[model samples]
Target: MTMPQMPDSPGTARPFSAELWTAIDPVYAAILDHPFITGLVDGTLPHDAFRHFVVQDSHYLRDYARALAVCAARAPGEDDVRAFAGDAAGAIAAEQEMHAEFMDRLGGSAAQAAAQPVGPTTRAYTSYLLATVYGGSFLDGLAAVLPCYWIYARVGEALLAKSSPDPLYRRWIETYGDEAFQGVVRRVVALADRTGAAATPEQRAAAVEHFVTTSRYEWMFWDAAWRRETWPV
Candidate 1:
């Protein structure tokens, strides 16, 4: 897809992160209208579906944290290094605490949930992310991971406007919509902007590709959960 360019004055251009968003805005809009998301907003999503999502997401977060740590190690700036490290730790904690609570509510422990087989879509998405981060540049890693941070914040804020009636759904929405998570996402975006500004044209194009690929994965993730995706073999 051709990226939509934002209007800019002479000698002034929009942040690369803004360009990334513009490129994915169509995907984002499609995600918002997805059955999984619509169900979350209306409290019509099945408990089993949410449980599957939580379990799969727990697995995803663990590997995502590893990718973030890689980014931390590769970061040129000390501040970015610290920021990525902190975000890595946060992903680990979110995986443990957030998923654990939801797991329990769904009548299982984290251990039990972890023991469950990884769904096909979950495996594919996480594998793609890990491959991108481990083999790619810092900007590439940021682009690969940005969708998880940015999309969740956008979805949370959107859902918060018409919060779910189901207490469980509301809890999930509020977790992402809360001020602290929002701040975390903003910092990541700023980091992306800074890193992307210095990137060469080829690198910038690669970042855009990674960003779009992951954004598609983000949509696939929710759809997978909604469908209770499984290995066909």
Candidate 2:
């Protein structure tokens, strides 16, 4: 299928800096602290909670795939951009297929799950990503979505460390703790660094905004989930 196209943009660029990393650190930490996310690692999360998580994640990935497709379409014809797009396509496919199966095994049905609307935090974060992919430079799009990689890696490592005895959590950890998944995160980080290396000041600012906005939304998602608030219609 033909991928969706991003809106046209002027071909401008930017440079990466330590400040960007520093700006995103708190966001990284907050995602790590998300109760539902951390619960996956600690094996303390209820199965129903995971069921809810998986359902929401499945919904999120659908949008994520579209966002990546937009990124791929916007990518420059250069080798590095092409490589990033190719890797992103593979990553999105694996996430969509494997995670869906994992959820199925956990008693989630694709039909029922697909019908679930994205939670508020998920909707906001993904909308921002779609906007970046369509409207921002390629590097900014990379920055906008890179936090998922970093957060997943962190969560996977913690889960692996704690994986044992608990069959349920073991299954969860094994899915993300494997070399293949880690490789995906590593590849994205490298892409982010490379893309960031050439980012302009405006691009950097945009990246920071994307990072902070998504990160804050991530924190609130967990908070809302924990409180069992009825997400807005």
Candidate 3:
């Protein structure tokens, strides 16, 4: 389903993220229709596809933590650095605990998860994040990382409201939809706004470009998992 149009008034709206999500609402709306997401939420997703997702996501989160660390390193202020650093630590911990638990239930062992080759789209998505973090400005890195948090929160709430009957899927939805996660999204959105406000027009434009690119990758990543994508070789 297409995302509903945003209302025209900032006076009664949540600040910061409204504009950023608005710019890319269509991309996110398409995400709602992706088979991987729909099937997962509705409990009809093939277990193998979900397994592939868990493995690939396990790999992605590690590189994601590294990318976030890179962002922390490039932070313009101590506060930004601290916030990103904390988030990086959170990402790292999830692999060890949360991902491990889910993978265990799915018959995935740590060694196996580690041994599996990263899928093509997983590699591309993480590479883009790292590239943006390493080569682009601080604001650019922020924009790139925002979708990981923002999209999860948005999708989580949507799926959670449907009251998924699948325990695994419900757990996943609550993980993102919970109050704590939303708080983090809010803080990151505020940070993005602050970064954009201080950046040059060129820098802001570059950041938006990165945001849009990453948003598309978010869709591609799910579609890749749905297909259980692998290298042709």
Candidate 4:
């Protein structure tokens, strides 16, 4: 379904257009449609595969924490913006802690896995996101990161629907499909719209670059996951 047009206001940015949504929707959909990721949600992915992802995700979250710190530093005086940064940071922390425990449970070491050079897809996506957050305007950074939120919500919802009687799947789905996680996506999208509304041509161009870059990277991430041996480390 198409996203509804957000109400326009002087402070509101251009609503996510059909064209832009069309561009991003496929990227988001690709992630949701990935068999490995889908299996993860359903607890059908082999334990080894799930454990590998847990390690990779732990690495990803470290970069995410740094990006959140940069965003917090760049945020303007708006309390909501600051709170959003804080929320991002908190999410990163929780992900890190949870993944660390999961790693231990699987007989892995967070430090070793983190120190290993990231896969090409992981490096590309996280580096681009961090660079955007530090080098671009706050709104532009939000645009770059917003896809992750959008994709997560979509994936989470799908997982929730496919959840089985398995306690593990139920726990995973519950954590991601909760209202709080959905709230994060809503707030970020709203922030993006607000930013887009006020953006200068240059700002809009930057945001678009981030949008495209992120979309492409999302596909690469899935591709790498599907073919781990061929994926660059």
Best by TM-score: 1
- Write candidate 1's Cα lDDT for 1-233 as tens digits: 11233576689867998889989989999999998899988989999999999989998898889988998999888998999999999999998898899898889999998898898988898899899999999899899999999999988888888899888899999998888888888888888889899999899999999999999999999999999998999
Error of 2 at 5 (Å): 34
TM-score of each: 0.95, 0.78, 0.92, 0.81
Worst 10 residues of 3 by lDDT: 1-10
Which prediction has more favorable TM-score, 2 or 4?
4
Tens digits of lDDT, candidate 3, 1-233: 22333566756633335667877889989999988889867899887888888889989999999999999998888998899999999998887887788888888786788799998999999999999899888888889998998898889878877757778877888888787888888788878877787777688778888898999999998898889899999
Error of 1 at 122 (Å): 1.1
Best-performing candidate as measured by lDDT: 1
Tens digits of per-residue lDDT for model 2, 46-160: 7776666666667677677777777777666565557556656765675567667767787866667778767777777778878887887777777777666655665667668
**lDDT of model 4, residue 231:** 49
lDDT of 3 at 216: 91
Model 2: lowest-lDDT 10 consecutive positions: 1-10
lDDT on C-alpha atoms for all candidate structures:
0.89, 0.66, 0.84, 0.68
Better of 1 and 2 by TM-score: 1
Model 2 off-target regions past 4 Å?
Answer: 1-18, 77-96, 221-229
